[model samples]
Target: MKIIAGLGNPGKEYEHTRHNMGFDVIDELARRWHVTLWKEDMKAEIGQTLVNGEKVLLVKPLTYMNNSGEAVGAIARYYKVDLDDIYIICDDLDLPPGKTRIRKKGASGGHNGIKSLIAHLGSENFNRFRIGVGHPQDGHTVVEHVLSRPYGEDIQKIEDAKIHTADSIESALKDGVDHAMNVFNPKRKG
Candidate 1:
């Protein structure tokens, strides 16, 4: 079984905020796949489905952002899923809005959620699908920037990124992670 977990704080106030980018992408995928029924399991909301004959679990952790691993670890253990089959979606403050990136393995890059995942999983070998939320600008703290919703053009940019993230995950499911990375990852100008 494949586990696709999206990191976010669970609450109406957190909806569509920059910090909830992971949840936004999962919600997009769920909508596209018609996964309307979500059940609580392992401290998370789970939507089950099949993609290319592979059983997939769409998970939304309810342990908030900082402690997401508690839920993810439990689900992974319960299902006996391999680390290679786990995909984590989360927001990235390093990249500008409207961009996304896929990494097979990496450190958390200061993301509390990913940090928790690494702590619980006992490895940094799972897949990551990151949506850029941009860095905190002006006098705004990182917390304020992430907890708030985007405005004006940034709002549209984030919405587009969410759709792109979902498409990339679908591609990863159908083709392979390498193929998805090649297609979705932006080229760096060196």
Candidate 2:
């Protein structure tokens, strides 16, 4: 079985913030798979279904962003899922807006949520699908930018990123990370 954990804060207040991009992607995946995220175990809202004949557990941790690992580790332990079988989707500020990157494994790069997961899992060897939210203009704090909502063209870019995140996740589950990376990492023209 594979576990996909989308990291973000819970509650309506965090619904559309840049920090919640992970939740947005998982929500979209649930919608596409016709699955209901009603199960309330593992400290998360979870949906179970078969994607490409593979048993998949889609999770949105309710422990919020910083403590995301608690929920994810719980689910992983319960399901006997290995680190390689787990995928984390979260927002990245280093890449330009609307861009996405899929990495087989890596450090958290100072992301609190990913850091928390690493602490709980005791390793940095997990797949990650990072959706770029872009950095703020000069003199803006990253905390402020990530907690804020996107506007205008930025909003459309965020939406597109979410869609692509879901597609890449599906590809990863169906065809492996290398295939997903090859198909998704390059720039695409409209």
Candidate 3:
């Protein structure tokens, strides 16, 4: 069994915000997999499906962004899923907008959602799919930037990123994390 969790705040107002990239990707995956029903459990909206003969749970935490760990940790424990079988999707303010990076294990990079997950899960060994939203600019505060929806070309960029992220997740499921990382993660210029 594999648990794929997307972190974001829960509310109609939070939809399409930069910080809700994770939820957007989850929706994309749900669409691709034909998952139409979501049950509320473990403080999350869960859609269960079979991907390549693997039982996959697509999760959108309902605990909001900062307290996401509480729901994710409870689900992981109840499901008895190994840390390696858990995957996290979230926004990254470091990379350029629409870019993505995958990490096997690491620090949260100051992301509150990731920090909460680490605190609740008692480890940072899970896989992460980070969709870049970029940092604030033009005197915009981080909170304001993350909460606001994208505009103009950025709208297309983020839409493309969501598809790219869903493809990457499929690759990780079909192949292995190492292989998926090689295929999806951009080659860094030394």
Once model 3 is optimally superposed onto the true structure by TM-score, how far is the C-alpha of residue 83 displaced, in angstroms? Answer: 0.7
Estimate, for each residue in 167-188, the C-alpha lDDT of model 3 and write its tens digit: 9999999998888899999898
Which residues of candidate 1, in runs, are more than 4 Å off? none
Compared with the true structure, all predictions reach lDDT values of 0.93, 0.90, 0.93
For the record, the alpha-carbon RMSD of candidate 3 to the native fold, in angstroms, is: 0.8
**Between the candidate structures 2 and 3, which one is better when assessed by TM-score?**
3
Candidate 2 Cα lDDT to native: 0.90
Clashes of 1: 0
- Cα lDDT of model 1 by residue, 39-110, tens digit: 998899999988889999999999999999999999999999999999999999998987899999999999
Alpha carbon lDDT at 119, candidate 1: 95
- By descending TM-score, how would the candidates be arranged? 3, 1, 2
Against the true structure, candidate 3 reaches a TM-score of 0.98
